[model samples]
Target: MPYVEVSLPVRAERSEIYPILKEMEKYPEFMADLVSVEVVERKENSTITKWVSNVDGRIIKWTEVDLFDDANMHISYKQIDGDLKKFEGEWILTPVADGTEIKLTVDFEFGIPMIAGLLNPILKKKVRDNSLNMLTAIKERMENRA
Candidate 1:
């Protein structure tokens, strides 16, 4: 298994960030390489989303269940259906000064065990880039909102 975690400060409130985070389907518009996302099912504070992301010219698709925790300002997700064998993560938001500290943690494992070890290094870079890209998109959108 490979894990990646990143924490960044966003000049946004928990209230503002939480809603945007729940609407994961909108990320493809702002995030690089994210081509499309569809909401398969949604219930109180939880949703099943189908995503298609372009990486290295290949489109990777996955479906994940997002669990939102308003009180804690956090959202966690696990891949319920996807091309990958295993994928899970969480987004944590902590109120700071006049903004919020957002942290994203991702745990993933490739389907092919033999190649997983060999691809770990490159996979780590992609995960980190994706995480940072996500935060950057969030910050850009929330800050520029009218």
Candidate 2:
């Protein structure tokens, strides 16, 4: 398994940013790497979503369950069915003196143990870059709105 975490400070309050984060389907509008995000099911505090994203020109698809903690401005998600063996992570929003700090994490497994050693490093970098891109996109969207 490989884990990647990226964070960005947005010039907005946590409360102002939480709602935008909940709108997963709108991500594709600002995120170039994301092809689409569809909400398959919506629950009281969670949502099941299907995602299609391009990573270095390779298309990756997944379905995930997202658990929302509105009070804490946090969201945790795990793949129910996807291209990867395991994919899970969380988004955390913390208010600071200047603005809000948004953190995104990703944990994944390529599933092929034999070649894990050879591929993990490259995969990690790609994942990290993707995560950073996501955070940057969110930050831009939030800041520009204000």
Candidate 3:
């Protein structure tokens, strides 16, 4: 398994950031690498979302369940089905003096045990870069809006 985490400060309140984060389906509008995000199902505090993302010209698709913890300023998601063997992560926001500190953590695995040793390092970097890209995208959007 490979794990990666990235964090950045956003010029906005947790209150403002939480809603935009809750609206997962609007990601593509601000994140160019995201192809689309559709709400497949909804529950009181969770949702099943279908996602299509482009990474280095490769398309990756997945359906994930997202649980929103508005009171805690957090949201976590795990893939139910996807191109990857495993994918899960969480977004956490904490109030900071100037704004909010947002963190994105991703855990993933390619599931190829035979090549795990050889690929884990490379894959880990890729996942980390992707995670950073996601945080960067969100920060850009929220900061510009503020």
The local distance difference test score of each candidate is: 0.88, 0.93, 0.90
Tens digit of per-residue lDDT, candidate 1, span 54-133: 88787888999999887887899999988888889999888999799889999988889889889977888988888898
Off by over 4 Å in 1: none
Q: Count clashing residue pairs per candidate.
A: 0, 0, 0
TM-score per candidate, chains pooled: 0.94, 0.97, 0.94
Task: Show the lowest summed lDDT stretch of 10 residues, model 3.
Answer: 126-135
The all-Cα superposition gives candidate 2 an RMSD in Å to the true structure of 0.9
State which candidate, 1 or 2, has the greater TM-score.
2
Among the numbered candidates, top lDDT falls to 2
Clashes of 2: 0
What is the Å distance of residue 56 in model 1 from its true position?
Answer: 2.1
